[model samples]
Target: MFKGLRETIRAYQERDPAARSGVEIFLLYPGVHATIYHKFAHFLYRHRLFFLARFVSQWSRFWTGIEIHPGATIGRRFVIDHGMGVVIGETAEIGDDVLLYQGVTLGGSGKEKGKRHPTIGNNVMIGSGARVLGSFKVGDNSRIAAGAVVVAEMPPNSTAVGVPAQIVKVAGERVNYTKELDQIHTPDPVSLEIQKLTECTRRLEKAMRELEEKRHEDI
Candidate 1:
């Protein structure tokens, strides 16, 4: 009700520092306006008023590029930064202190029913255009890299990156993805090192197989 509205406005202020006034936020920022309206629409949906809920949600989506389903359960202080084309599925459960950039989709991996959408943990950051699908769990305090397509489950405080997103590093690590929206750079030296290690493993396995054969022949 009024609580959600106040919270949404506060979130806008905390999220976007460039927002000079609440009037500017209400008028100019589509992201803020969209979230505010979605909150009411979602409430209506929970109360079994499906038709009106959908009408308001569709209206909000038309005005803003963000498409938040009324059935989706979003936590307090939820912020959609640059929320164009963000599609949160009906079954998606987003935890508190979560951040999502433009074009992020929390969708289903399969056609089955019952909790098809992804369950995101608290303090997690989903980068722009990242697609985290299925009923997988995204661990708390994790960062999903930009444009990553994650279908597998992520570990707590770990970072998932690349297509079919791999958990590259454990907790207490860092990734430099500054200005990635402008142009993403590949051939990362850090990941390249990991790739080289994988190649070395293959070579070692081949060498071990040859040695084992020679030893067996001698026997």
Candidate 2:
């Protein structure tokens, strides 16, 4: 447990430039506190102490503003940056080295019986305000852009952006998205579509002008 705590603190230091020291993170970081509470709660939950587990989780939520269900499975080095308003549902399973920003939700789409929440793969980065709903698998090394609403499976090494999130980059050279949070500079699919349409319209107009000139010459 001490090893795990050390690893978590190290991860925070590496990922967050603002993080000063391990002692400060242990003492002051809400995310670290939430994670510590979750470990204890999860242990109780696995031992069938459901009520106690829930109580602990609720207390953690009250104090940290991050609600993580005790039944949820979280792997090592899972960092939640600015963790306020982050929600991890009961059935959600998060893999190792995953990073989630503030206001991210791993929630269910409907009133399902089992496996309702999303399964996040290793090394995934979910940006702030992203909603990954339903029982989908967000693959390894994938990046979900800020404010994206993903309802489907994202392939490995991909980047998902926009509302009803679209896979913009897939299976390419790996980019360390967890270290970067520049949401404004990510690819805009809407702008690309508009540019394509404008180019097509220009081509059509040029073709029509040439046809008109040819007809006049024949006359």
Task: Using TM-score, give the best candidate's number.
Answer: 2
Give the per-residue lDDT digits (tens) of candidate 2, residues 1-219: 999999999999988889999999999888999999999999999999999999999999999999999999999998999899999999999999999999999999999889999999998999899999999899998899899999999988888899888887754667586467676577778888999999999999999999999999999
lDDT of 1 by residue, 1-219 (tens): 667656666767776667777677767777777778888999999999999999999999999988888888888767787789999898899997677889999998879988899999887778889999999898887778888899989887777778877775554743322213222443343677789999999999999999999999999
Whole-model Cα lDDT per candidate? Answer: 0.80, 0.92
- lDDT for 194 (candidate 1): 85
Q: Cα RMSDs of all predictions?
A: 5.9, 1.5
* Model 1: lDDT of residue 101: 86
Give residue 94's lDDT in candidate 1 (0 to 100).
91
45 Cα displacement, candidate 2 (Å): 0.9
Global fold similarity of model 1 (TM-score): 0.77
